[model samples]
Target: MKNYKISAIATTKIPPERIFAVLDDFGSWPTWMPSFERVKVDLPTNPVPHLNYQFRLRGSVVYADMQVIEYTALSRATSFRINVPPLTGVNRCSIRPLSQGRYRIDRIDTIDLPKVVVGVLDATQRARFSRLAQEFLTALLRTAEMRG
Candidate 1:
């Protein structure tokens, strides 16, 4: 198996608190995120906090089920893979307070896949992942800015 780690950072003109608020609310993802077509937990009301959910990719229709492993208010959030064959990865989002009403948003994704498929997948999937990550962060930043 081969490990793939993708890390990205973005500077936003929004406060850390606002950014963290948006990041913590997983239910609101589909509202602002263009890449996620649907997001639903197992419950209707108040759902089971920290539960897992299956997400459908907007274009590719790829589905990935992820479980909420760690969620710290206004600081850090982490999730673990629960689906997607032969791939187990942890997704983490963090926010740091920066100078002058600015904040640093960081996403760290660690994926483990088979070595044989790496070359084939890398050429096609890497760009898609990168673009998705960038778009997700950018959307979050835009939402936070609008809320301010």
Candidate 2:
């Protein structure tokens, strides 16, 4: 299988804690993130600390379920993975405080798939996903700014 990685970084005026909190709240994703049509927790009534969530992507009718495997509240780092058919990727989101009132948001996604499919995706589909990531980060920063 071939591996695909896409990364993006953006600076925001918001603090790491606020950014991390917003990101950790999976249910609120659709509200702030325009790319998702819906995000629902299929588990128990109470919140699951390291839970898995199922989300339906907007525009396209694709559905993916990802597990929140890593979370570090102090460092403001969280990661999720989708290990199912059609999509197999890991997404890591982090925030680091910079000098002054600025903070940096970094996102990295690595996907694994067949080599032939990866080559095709690299030529055509990967760019779209990259753009989506950029837009998502931009919207996230804007949302955070507007809330303050």
Candidate 3:
């Protein structure tokens, strides 16, 4: 098996709770998250460890499953195990206060790809994951800032 690790970081003036609020709302993901034609969650909101959600890829029949494996409300941190067929991902998003009215948001993803298919496409997928992580952070910040 081959592993690909990626981290996306950015600074924002929004509060941690505000940013986290957007994450808690799965229904709103389609507005910001790319490739998510539809999302389904067993719980209403406020994700905690063990909570699960699923999303259908846009223009595709594939359905991805994501399960929350860690969550810290006070720290505004959450981790998930994402399974989308041949590849499995462990993704974490966290927010830390940087200064007064400033904070940093990070999205770290580690994808375990099969060794057999870990050739040229591996690089492409890594790049894709990095883009998605960065995009997720940017969208989350935008959504949170717009809400308040």
- Which is superior by lDDT, 2 or 3? 3
Stretches of candidate 2 off by over 4 Å are: 38-43, 48-62, 74-85, 122-124
Lowest-sum lDDT 10-residue window in model 3: 50-59
- Candidate 1 is scored at a TM of 0.74
Candidate 2 C-alpha lDDT tens digits along 1-148: 8778887889887876677666766667778886565544343355544534333323234445555655675333333334335657677878777888887888888887778876676545777888888988887777766765
Off by over 4 Å in 1: 43-65
Q: Give one digit per residue, the lDDT tens place, for model 1 in 28-101.
A: 76689764556543323653344343332222333455566666654454544544453677787777778887
What are the RMSDs of all candidates, in order? 3.7, 3.5, 3.7
Candidate 3 per-residue lDDT, tens place, 1-148, comes to 8886889999998877787778767556777776554654444354433344433223244445555555575233333444445567677787777877788788877778677666757677778878988887888888898998
For all candidates, what are the clash counts?
0, 0, 0
Tell me each candidate's TM-score: 0.74, 0.77, 0.75
What's model 2's lDDT at 47?
A: 52
Clashes by residue pair, model 2: none
Question: Number of the top candidate by TM-score?
Answer: 2
- In order, candidate lDDTs are 0.67, 0.66, 0.66
